[model samples]
Target: MSRLPDAPPPGAILEAAVYVSDLDAAEAFYGELLGLPRLMRVPGRHVFYRVGATILLVFDPEGTTVPTSDPAIPVPPHGARGEGHVCFAATDAEITAIRARLAAAGVEAEADFRWPNGARSLYVRDPSGNSVEFAERALWG
Candidate 1:
């Protein structure tokens, strides 16, 4: 039914974007907590961070002129709960420390998930109520 490339190597994931209510606060949380390097910033509008081989973009929802409703599509209200979140991979040791750090910083986290692929993860929220996850893959060992 479909053609496929023969023996094609897997390509690296480049980037993902998440819209946020406050650009500055998102920048602070990710930059400080996850230790991601800030790659770029657009005044009052957007911030991009380097996460491993991927780029994570945080855009200000209020600053964007995109319409909330249209005949073809509908957008969620700003800061809607359970919409989406970003996940960052870490080492097992780092994962434990990060959870403690987030707790001390007053960030709430869901119970950790230990997957069959030897990966463990925990979910937490940022200042804007968007969820975030920290994961560690045992395969790295």
Candidate 2:
């Protein structure tokens, strides 16, 4: 056995989730356009994307409300449905390539600018209307 704290650490975000009504569109935009690797997919239900060590889970709100197992799993119902935002750390090359890829896919950026800290960001919406951002932190000196 190991001796680690049972409580979660102060600043660790292990995973994030966004509820989407359509899985196909989500997969196409996140997996194909954003190039996030698809970790797994439950047909007509959910899709998981690996963003570095963080897992991005996109689930169909209508289908995901059901309990995980017959015993109910003692988990709260997440049945959330709406637009959410997620940002990924990107390199300068990735920022450029993402812009090109979005253009190729006919997806326009809602906003693009550099923050006061010299971080650059581009915001775009996935097919389900969730805002996705690709950011490069202080990449240009």
Candidate 3:
């Protein structure tokens, strides 16, 4: 096998995913409610959104678990049916606005927290029960 180059670790994350039970609801929540730009949507399968430079993919577990590609172009089937977590970075002002918007849309925050370092975050569940967090920039940086 060829060895990888001896170099520093990758500098950025290009994509992250959360498997969901309902693709449509996921789209409405992450796409419409959160204001993340909708990059692509494969109905009944997955929805991709632009979160900064990362592609946030919300995939329907059932649709993704089975191979659908033709024999000439094999594609592996991979998926899991369970909740996953992804934390998104947000500023203090943006967090406040997010809380207000969620409230206006009737979605309740599951929890809100202040870290020991003074960073704050709020958690909510998507339609498929995935834990979603919007945290202050300092929390992860």
* Top-scoring candidate (TM-score): 3
- The model with the greater lDDT, 2 or 3, is 3
Better model by TM-score: candidate 1 vs candidate 2: 2
**Candidate maximizing lDDT:** 3
Q: Name the regions of candidate 1 deviating beyond 4 angstroms.
A: 1-10, 62-82, 116-118, 138-141
Q: Ranking under lDDT, best-scoring first?
A: 3, 2, 1
Error of 2 at 30 (Å): 1.2
The best-first sequence of candidates by TM-score reads 3, 2, 1
Misplaced by over 4 Å in model 2 are: 1-8, 70-75, 138-141
C-alpha lDDT (0 to 100) for residue 66 of candidate 2: 75
In order, what lDDT does every prediction score? 0.76, 0.85, 0.88
Q: Report the Cα lDDT for residue 42, model 1.
A: 75
Of candidates 3 and 2, the better by TM-score: 3
| lDDT score for candidate 3 against the true structure | 0.88
lDDT of 3 by residue, 1-141 (tens): 999889888999899999998887898899889989998888878899999979998888888877876799676887876789999998888888998999899889998888989999999888889999999989866
lDDT of 1: 0.76
- Give the per-residue lDDT digits (tens) of candidate 2, residues 24-131: 989998898778899999887789999887999998988777766656466655767689988888886888898888988999989988888878899998888899
The TM-scores of all predictions, comma-separated, are 0.72, 0.84, 0.89
Give candidate 3 regions above 4 Å deviation.
1-7, 70-75
* True-vs-predicted CA distance for residue 4, candidate 3, Å: 8.0
What is the number of residue pairs that collide in model 3?
0
TM-score of model number 2: 0.84
